[model samples]
Target: MTDHIDGALALSWMNTFTEDFHAAQQALTDLDRQAGDGDFGTNIASALRKVVAELPTADDATFASVFTATANGFLATGGTSGPLFGMWFRAVSRSTATEGTDTDLLAQGVAAGLAKVQTLGGASVGDNTMIDALAPASQALLDASTGGLTVDKALTSAARAARAGAASTADLLAARGRASYVGDLALGVEDPGAVTVAIFFEAGAAALSA
Candidate 1:
């Protein structure tokens, strides 16, 4: 019943994102085949399933607990992306407190998460990684938080930014992770990581609006 980006909303977003991921799992699998080991969809889906199982009920969950569950779940999964996502979520969990209903705190957690992803992956925007989608989405959330907008508006902006960022990755050369092994051959295909990030932001937006 959460209407914003609180711990409850995070759980709602995960459910929505997982459903969306399942719908696009085949496409994700195909995209990964071009640049990675063809297991990105499977890995992310598996991680989400574990996260859902580990997390407490929405009413019982705290912001920190939500992210902590996500981090642990992603870490338990197999693949290079798993550890990178684990680091991002862990940083977010560490940044979060037990409180809820503060846009600034959510923004801070996302900023912290982005920083961890950058540091761990040694990636920046346009790196043909999840960072590409995450960076712009975080910036959008920050802007919305600074502007004193509603969480739904902020998440909508973030989702849009993520989509645009992911689309842009279609032309980027892989600069990190397993995708980097493919070099320029990754051209003309969106990075699967970025696409998944976009879906997550989209789910967040939908959850907050609901």
Candidate 2:
């Protein structure tokens, strides 16, 4: 119920994300094969594994430092997702750093990350992309923070929204990213990116609540 997400919580979040990525790797690969290239699972998994391995050893070990390292590491990757997600991590790092120890830090970080993703990806709420999950979860976190909800409650609410958003993509045609090429073929298949974001929120909530 603490408002602060200190360095410990930040490291814990990354660990949870890494574990979640590992758990979902196969499912994400399978989902990607249904509509786009099948490498989403492997690529994202490898990137997160790198983050887990490298970020925690920084001299400061602050929340900002860990997330900043994550951003910098992923920025080195090739292709669209790498740079975009790298920017997403950067936004989160900057937002939290700017907010200092405020109770709303996590919400601000998530919202900032989602904004960067929207800007870079040029995708909207129902685009059958990660934005589907990210947008809702960001809003939920913002709402919870504004309403003075505890960290656990806010993250849990955000996780629920993210999962719902990801599931809703199953019936929508792909309106963005490589999946867009599949057109109707993407229908009935949940977007891999959206599912990944769902995993992220779910892990964050679990880590904070635990």
Which portions of model 2 miss their true places by more than 4 Å? 58-60, 97-103
Task: Give the Å shift of residue 79 in candidate 1.
Answer: 1.2
User: In candidate 1, what are the lDDT values of residues 76-130, reduced to their tens digit?
Assistant: 9988888888888887676555555456666787888898888878999978899
- Could you tell me every candidate's TM-score relative to the true structure? 0.92, 0.92
Q: How much lDDT does each candidate structure score?
A: 0.84, 0.81
Clash totals for all candidate models: 0, 0
Give per-model CA RMSD.
2.0, 1.9
Angstrom error at residue 8, model 1: 2.8
